[model samples]
Target chain A: MIPVITAFDRSPDGGKGLARDTRVRWALEEAGQSCDVRPVSFASLRQPAHLALNPFGQIPTYEEDDLVLFETGAIVLHIAERHNGLLPVDAAARARAIAWMFAALNTVEPPILERQTAVLLESDKPWTAERLRSIDQRIDVRLGQLSARLGDDEWLDGGFSAGDLMMVSVLLRLGSSGLLDKHPGLAAYLARGEARPAYRRAFEAQRTFNTRPGPSE
Target chain B: MIPVITAFDRSPDGGKGLARDTRVRWALEEAGQSCDVRPVSFASLRQPAHLALNPFGQIPTYEEDDLVLFETGAIVLHIAERHNGLLPVDAAARARAIAWMFAALNTVEPPILERQTAVLLESDKPWTAERLRSIDQRIDVRLGQLSARLGDDEWLDGGFSAGDLMMVSVLLRLGSSGLLDKHPGLAAYLARGEARPAYRRAFEAQRTFNTRPGPSE
Candidate 1:
């Protein structure tokens, strides 16, 4: 059964991959799987209909056959696991790849999200500058560490697994912040991920959704 | 081979399970395994010795005979994958459980971490309150969605798995915020997770470490 997932009718980022749905779309495109996107309004998301598929009432809940799944990472991972392209055959390499995936979301992405939060919610706050510095520093520290490890390496672990997909998606958030430019390797690394045909496909798909006109009057 | 992970010499929370190490400890405890704690000072965490194990210079990196893993979610998932208790035998259920793990870290924890950043680094700023509200509202929305889904359900999915362990750990961050109390089900749900014997053991172990004295002169 073809899985259907939800996305914002219009993303705040002008359809940049910052939206979580982009990750799922990227994964589906990577796996060579075609799926349907169900655009949801903020109000409708809270309704019982949407809530049932995703208890968290978030975007990108996967419904395939009798199975329903939420969480973009999980959905991406599910796609990676079920299909052959997203993970390597080696057991150890696969585990390491999965580790990188967790690191991307759990470790690297937190500070980036904080930066966005500061910009979106606290720009007028008195402590905004200090908070921004701290957030930027934390992000730099993580980037420096990751850069050292990556050290000219292509992907985080073995070849481009779902881990790379997620990591690149995450690093893309730093585009507006300019913090990523400070780390040359990471900057180049993200460009490489974006250059992927699948990524371009996924980006275009979500962009199309975001730019599309709303329902008829 | 037994895995030895690091813990804070004195957890900032004074033994509260907020310490990331608690998650790793919980995983080990639930797996019916015994592990060692190599407590590290904040300075040591930055030193080359500890940095070799975890590039991010964070706590709760797992070290077995040959493999070393960082990121609590990754380490916990690794432990669960190798051991029997934390993952389900059914493939689909297992996928769902793993998804929850991703959901907990990637989806749920990000906003909470953002709130923490605002409180810790931006509290002195003029826009602190505004930023905090925006961040908190984001978290609140997520929590509301989660609360509704967890309504009466004991755990996120079937019998307690790594997913619940992660979900509960993420929810515990809201303790001081009082946001959880607003949703009785999630609050009680968090309590159910804390009430687990394994969770209690993990909490106490971190507490003991945090309360213990440092290597004296």
Candidate 2:
């Protein structure tokens, strides 16, 4: 059965591929899997129907057979577990890769998301400029540590795995912030991830879906 | 071989069990697994030795045999996958449980962590009070959605799994915040988690470890 995943009907990013569905799509592309995308309107996201699939009422939920899963990390993991390309076959290496996934979402993404909250939610506040500075400093610390760890390596560990996929996706959020340019190695790292065939395919698919004209148009 | 996990020599919370290591301890207790805890001082966290294990320079790195793992979510998940207690036997149910784990760390904890950043790091800022109010509102939206989904259910899903362990751990961070009081169901859910025998054992172990007198004293 082709799995079904949800995406925003009209993404807030306007085709920037940062709405998280892109992560799932990239994972699926890497795994050589096909899925059906169901665009969910912002109004429907909070309704009982959507909330039944995900309590938090967020998009990019996955449904295959009888299983319904939410959380991009979990959904991508579900795909990676079922398919072969996304995770290493070795046990220890696979665990390490999973650790990076958590580190991306739990450790790395939190500060970046804080920056988002500051920019998107509290942009008009008097302290926005100061808060942005603090948030960026925190993001730089993580990026520095990540650059140190990735020194002279192609991927985070051995070859590209779900860990790098997640870390790259998280760092992609910094595309407009100019933070990636500060760490040349990380910028190159992000570039390598973006240059992946699977990533390109995923990005193009989301771009087409997001930019397509609506019924009114 | 027995696993060794790193933890704070002196937890900033002073045995309140808010440290990420407590989540690992709780997972270990549930799995009926015992691990040796190595005390890592704040001064040593950023040193080369610690960074070798975790580039993020954070405590609670798990080492067993040749494998070294960081990230509390990953460690707890490794334990859950190996042990029989923390995940469901059914494949679909297992995926859902894992989704809750991501939800706890990624969705719920980020705002709560922002609250931490505000209180702990930005307390002296002029906008501290206003920023906190904004952060609290974001946290409440998540808590409200979680409570609605939980309803009268005993756990987030079926029998208490790692998902509950993680969600409870995330919610415990709000103990002194009094936000849990606003959602009675979530508060009761948290109490249920703490009331578990495994949770009690985990709490006591950390409490004793953190309260122990140093040799110099």
TM-score of each: 0.92, 0.99
lDDT: worst 10-residue window of model 2 chain B: B208-217
Instruction: Give the native contact fraction of candidate 1.
Output: 0.76
| Model 2 C-alpha lDDT per residue in residues B31-91, reported as the tens digit of each score | 9999999999998999999999999999899999999999999999999999989999999
Number of the top-ranking candidate, with lDDT as the measure: 2
Clashing residue pairs in candidate 1 (N, C-alpha, C atoms within 3 angstroms)? A125-B126, A125-B127, A126-B125, A126-B126, A126-B127, A127-B125, A127-B126
- Model 1 error, position A137 (Å): 2.4
lDDT of 1 by residue, A153-176 (tens): 988886899989988988998886
Off by over 4 Å in 2: B215-217
DockQ (0 to 1) for model 1: 0.67
Candidate 2's residue-wise lDDT over A22-45, tens digit each?
A: 999999999999999999998899
For each of the candidates, the C-alpha root-mean-square deviation to the true structure, in angstroms, is 2.4, 1.2
Give residue A91's lDDT in candidate 2 (0 to 100).
96
Report the error of model 1 at residue B122, Å.
4.0
Best by TM-score: 2
Model 1 per-residue lDDT at B136: 78
Docking class of 1: medium
